[model samples]
Target: MPTVPSANPAEHLARTVDIVALLERGRAMSTPVLRAAVDRLAPPMNTVSSYHFGWIDAQGRPAEGDGGKAVRPALALLSAEAAGAAPEVGVPGAVAVELVHNFSLLHDDLMDGDEQRRHRDTVWKVHGPAQAILVGDALFALANELLLELGTVEAGRATRRLTTATRKLIDGQAQDISYEHRERVTVEECLEMEGNKTGALLACAASIGAVLGGADDRTADALERYGYHLGLAFQAVDDILGIWGDPESTGKQTWSDLRQRKKSLPVVAALAAGGPASHRLGELLAADVKSNDFESFSEEEFAARAALIEAAGGRDWTSEEARRQHAVAVETLDAVDMPEQVRAQLTALADFVVVRNR
Candidate 1:
C-alpha cells in the first residue's frame, strides 16, 4: 500500500496554538502563571523533561518554542472542551499529562537502548542511564506537583480518575519491559498490555475532559471506554508501522521492532499463523542477530509482512475498534451535557489519531 502523507507537526502545533488560545480566553485556570512556576519548580537532573518539552535549552537554560507534539495535552484539552468546561479548567492537568508522557519517553529510550528521540540524541544517550533515570524521576515528581495545583479536585471523583491513570501508566511500562523475556503472549494478554501501556493515559485524557466538561458519571465512563479503545487502536497501528514504515517518513527504522524482537501486533498476528513466519520468529527469540544480513529477508519481505498485518485483520480489527470507541466518545459528548461543536471537533481528532502516519 502507498503511504499517505504524515501529519505535519508544525501544522499540528498551529492547531494546538489555536486550542490554547480558546482555552486562555475562558481563562479558568491561570495557566500562564502556573506554567511559569512549573518551569521554575525543579532545575535538577539536567532538566531533560524541560528540554524534551522545549521549555529550556539543551544547556538547561530557558528557551522558547514547540515541545514534543503534546498529543496528550490536546486530548486532555479537547476532552475538557467536549465536556464544556472550556479546557481551561483542565489545562494544568493537561500539562501534567504532557510532562508525564515525555517522562515515559525519556525512560523508554533508555530501556529500549534507543539512540535518537525526535531526531536528537535520546536522554540516556546524552547523559547515561543513572542520570536519565533521575531525570525521569524528577519529572514524575513534577507531574504530581502540577496535579496538586489542580485545586480542590474531588478525590472522590476526578482526582481518582487522574491518579488511577498515572499509576496504570507505570504498570503498563512494567508489563512492556517484562514482555522482552516472554516467549509467547495470548492475544487477550496483548490487549491488556496495550490497555496498560497505551490505553491508560488516553483514558485519563478523556476522563479529565469529562471531569472538566462537568459531565456526570455515566458519560464519563463512556468517555473512558472511548479512550481505552482509541489507545488500543493507536498501539496496534504503531505496531504495524514499526515493522514497515519508511524510516525517513516515520523517523524510525522499518526493521527496528523486529530487530529488537518487540513482538508487536503484526509479529503477534504472524506468530498466530503457526507456519513459516511463526517458526522463524520463534527461532529468533532468545537468539542474537549475528550476521549482517539477519537471515536474508529483503526490505520487500518486510513490506509484505506489513500487508500481512492489514490482510490478517490486525490493522483492520484495531481500526474498527477505534471507530467503535469513537462512536462511544461521541455519544458521551452528545449527551446534552456538552456543546455539539466541541464534541464534534474532539471526535474528529480521535479519527485523526488512528490514521495519522506518525
Candidate 2:
C-alpha cells in the first residue's frame, strides 16, 4: 500500500503549497478555454457571460478579479494526472465542467435572489433576469457542444455523465426550495439533497478526466467517490461560512444564509439538537416564516441567532462533519494506484476544501 501523508500539523505547510500550485495550474489551463468558448456566443450574450465570469465589466471592457478558485476544474485535471495522463489531456473535460458549474451559478443566483457574488453584482442583478437566464442556457449548451467536439467515444461518455449530473443538480435545487417552506427538515434529507445538488457535479468532474484519459472503471469510480465526499465537505464548510464568515472574504453579507432562512447544514443541525438554543432559534425562524419576510433580520438579531446555533453545538458538529467528509475523500484516493505526487496533490486539495475561508 502506498503510504498517504497524514493530515498532521507537520504536513500543513507542504500541503498548502501543493494545493496552491495545483489550483494555479488549473486556473491557468481552464481560463483560456472558458474565454474562447464564451467568445463564441453572440454580442450581448458574450458580454453578459464574460461579465458573470469576471472576465469583463458591464461595458465589455477588461476587469480585474480572481474569477473563482476553479476547484472543480482543478479536480478534473488532477484526476487525469492521477490516471497517468498528461494534464493537457483533461483540458476539454475541465472546460466542460467549469461551464456547467457557471451555468448553474448563473441560474442559482437568480433563483436565490442573490445580489452579490465574489463581492460583485450577480449577472442577473447587472444584466436583468431574462438575459441572465438566456446566458445560462447558452453556457449549458456550450458545455455540451464543447464536450462533443472531443473524439466520439470520449465525448459520448462525458456527455452522458454531465447530463446526469445536471439533472441531479436541478432536482437538488428544487428540493432545497421546497425545504424552505417546510417547518422541519431532517439532517439525512439535507445530506442527500446536498449530494445531488453539489456532489453530482463534483463527482462527474473527478471522473471525466479519468474517462478521457482512458483510465479503468475502478480508478474512475474511486475518483468519483472522492469528489462526492469532497463536495459534502465543501458544502458543510460553506454552511459554516454562511453564518460566520467575513463578508469581504466570503463575498456576501455576513449571516446571509440566516437572513435568507436557508436550511443549510448548520441550521439543520441546530434545529435537530433540541436544546434551549434550538428552541429559541425555532421561534425566531417560525416568526420569520409567519411574517414571510426573510430580509427583516437585523444585524443584532442575526448575531443572536448565530450565537444560539453555536450554543446548541451546531457549529462544532458541522465543523467536525466537514473534517470527517474530508477524511473520507482522502481515503477514497487509496483505491487508485496513482503516482505519489498526484496522490499528494489530491490529498492537499481535499484538505483545502474543508479549510478554505470562502
Give the number of the best model, judged by lDDT. Answer: 2
After TM-score superposition, the amount by which residue 241's alpha carbon in candidate 2 deviates from its true location, in angstroms, is: 0.6
How many angstroms is residue 238 displaced in model 1 relative to the true structure, after the best TM-score fit?
1.3
Candidate 1, residues 234-322: lDDT per residue as tens digits? 77667756766667656666666765556566656555656554566555553433332445677675565555555555555554554
Clash pairs, model 2 backbone: none
RMSD of each: 5.9, 3.1
What TM-score, to 2 decimals, does candidate 1 have? 0.78
Which residue segments of model 1 deviate by more than 4 Å? Answer: 1-38, 55-66, 286-336
**Each model's TM-score, in the order given?**
0.78, 0.95
Provide the lowest-lDDT 10-residue window in model 2: 1-10
